[model samples]
Target: MSGSNKTDFTNPSTFILLGIPGLEASHVWISIPFCTMYAIAVLGNFTILFIVKMEPSLHGPMYYFLCMLAISDLVMSMSIVPKMLSIFWFNSREIDFNACLTQMYFIHCASAMDSGIFVAMALDRYVAICDPLRHSTILTNPVVAKIGLAVLLRSGLIALPLPFLVRQWPYCRTNIIRQPYCAHMAVVKLACADTSVSSYYGLFVLFCVMGLDVIFIIVSYIQILRDIFSLPTKDARLKTFGTCGSHLCAILAFYIPGLFSSLIYRFGQNIALHFHILIGTICLLLPTMLNPIIYGVRTKQIRDRVLRLFTHKGT
Candidate 1:
């Protein structure tokens, strides 16, 4: 990231991830809530999976998509949270280059899978609302399997090159990754190569994968809204809108903070490093923790199943 064209071909060294550097004294305190959030995220997502599997009445496209979303959140959060907590609690900040690359790949892949599942969920709603009769036909189990595979491939393949691109470059600038994990841009910034290609390629993947998904999601909503309003009765409209509320909240939770964090990262260079880290961490973790909760509250079946599970446990 230093404005120098010369490369330093020194031996590769480990990276030190100083988790929110300025507030080292309170790292333990900061990890307290993160630990709670991580625990909740793990348990809640599994609960969703278990309920979807055990409840035969819930064996359908919507619940399958929910399962995928839960799994994606679990993957994304698990990939980053443990290392992050280690950095905060134990100061276990040293990460090897290869391991960092692998983690970065998984993180991006999981994020892409999450976004893809969101789009699929939106499409599921569209079919359910706008074409009720054909909903089951259009999103059958085979189709859902294909959708899941596509999401995984798109995310895993697109992100595969990023680490290799960084690897080819010499990182003589510094071995300190400012954020808690080995983020793509953060790692790239440490490289002493012609990084413009890698940067542009990342943008390309972002737009091609997530941007396209967002556009389809928006279009699905537009069609869904049009159909809902055109219904003959207020009850029908209310019922339909109710179905979308949980998804809407989930979408906002995923994108709003995510986009805000990205914008700040791109524009707010003048901002303090620790604050940037806080917001970035929040964007990823908050959604991971909230999605399961949102789905549980919004879907009566899930709520009821959760209660039943607890009641049986009590018995």
Candidate 2:
């Protein structure tokens, strides 16, 4: 079956996607849950953005980071879901080379931005904890905007070379990507060339984007723990740590699955390739969709605003 669908070396223009295997025959039915999640993801993140915008009290660094995260989540959902839905709903799993490259680039950019927002949240925590006196000064509106721009440029620069590198592949054997979306490693693995370069690039970018962020966040939290432990008053210690509880939870939800997914994809022995598609979908989609809801429930300000908005509407 694989040999029949495989591309001939002489004619390689478009890629055929197996698209979740046995489910392709039943894509329409399978797509229902995916569609529902995608819808909820959009609505949930946008609602968080709206809440942050409407509440003047949330116009600070932490909320600024939250809003940025919401925007990133929105972009992340939009990048992959529509195509994923189309693939399942309409049975069109074919993505052209240019389109595939474009998809991979934008998706990576969104992923990087999402990860960067976590770093920004860490910085906010550091300022609020380590240098309370200058928190506002350190995270001014202008500085926040500058930081956002820097994140954009940095993520773009990191993901920019990936497409060109993949384009150089001659595609001697097959163009059939087994998954619905264009994943970097999945695509690179299909290349007939020596993939050591692409693999190195992928790992390097992953370290810079996710690895370094996780390390810094851990270090920051350790310092935060030290400061909290040193506080004289019980109430002071509780209050200081209270603000970080939501962020800590958010960081865990975002990074745990991410790190596991990367490690499994890169180094795990005898792992099925299809598991990559499944795990990647879960890691990328779940956090983007759930982050806002998690924060809204965990953070008092957001909860209060949500309650007030609903109360005002009822009145």
Candidate 3:
């Protein structure tokens, strides 16, 4: 091709995110529920952080891990929701090329970090239940801080190449992304050039992070269940099981939909594209919406703190 033709193939300065294909009529209605979910998620997570910070009794490994989880959810939710709401409510779908890449970086990195935080939470539970005596020594404050830093850095390193890889491609074809949020694969597909590098890196880090972390979490739970059942008394077993209610609820709410959505997106290409968009949106929002509620209701400490907050406010 000649230089003039090559020049004509230059990328668009901005990407127009077509929030949901074939569903523009319902976007105003859609924004109502989305706005509600986003507000709930952000407020709930911040509430958890506030309670954790204010309560001196919450300064343990379990709550430390909870703190990390709350922060991860906050980052993930904020990374996607504002732009998503903007698209839905105002049709402000046009995002600068660099801003879209920035969104992609934060969204994926925050998601990967959420997986690591869950792993950390699982380990915290395992230590608390299986080796109660060693929990403090093993998961000291300094050690927890290190684990948090490591989780963030791990995802940061893996997601570092995604923006550059996607950006280098020319968007000579479609400049519209299919989703409300700027997802890596969605953005990459809009590029006219080869997207193999970005695709492979995304898949590689996804499996590496999700694969190892989920396996370890399962193993930790197995050990936990075994330890619980081995206790001499039924009362002890019931008590131990009760302790896991919140975390288990969180795990199920998060991983099941998240994993299923991912699988369907990769393998169920024959399925309608709208289903993919809907499932992806649900998977991202549902866990975040439910997590704080689960912890607030199921964990006695958090529940008590919340009640006390209400009572004191009333007084």
Per-prediction TM-score to the true structure, in the order listed = 0.95, 0.92, 0.94
Error of 1 at 254 (Å): 0.5
Top-scoring candidate (lDDT): 1
Order of the predicted models by TM-score, top scorer first: 1, 3, 2
Per-residue lDDT tens digits for candidate 3, residues 1-315, read 223222445566777788888888898887787788889889999999999999999988778778878888888888888888888888898898889989889888877887888888898889999999998899999999999899889878877888888878877766778889888888888777777888888888877778898899999999999999999999999999898888889988988998899899879979888778988998988888899999999998999999999999999
Give the Å error, residue 32, model 3. Answer: 1.5
Assess candidate 2 and give its TM-score to the true structure: 0.92
Steric clash pairs (candidate 3): none
Model 2 regions lying over 4 Å from their true place: 1-12, 267-273
Query: Which run of 10 residues does model 3 get worst, by summed lDDT?
Result: 1-10
Question: Which candidate number maximizes TM-score?
Answer: 1
Q: Please provide, for model 2 over 1-315, each residue's C-alpha lDDT reduced to its tens digit, 9 standing for 90 to 100.
A: 366355546335666666676556777776776777788889888888899888899999899888888888888888888988888877777777788888899889888888888888888998899899999898999999998888888888888989888887767667888888888877887877787888889889887667887888888888989989899999999999999988888788888888888778768767766566667787888887678778989899999999999999999
- lDDT, model 3: 0.85
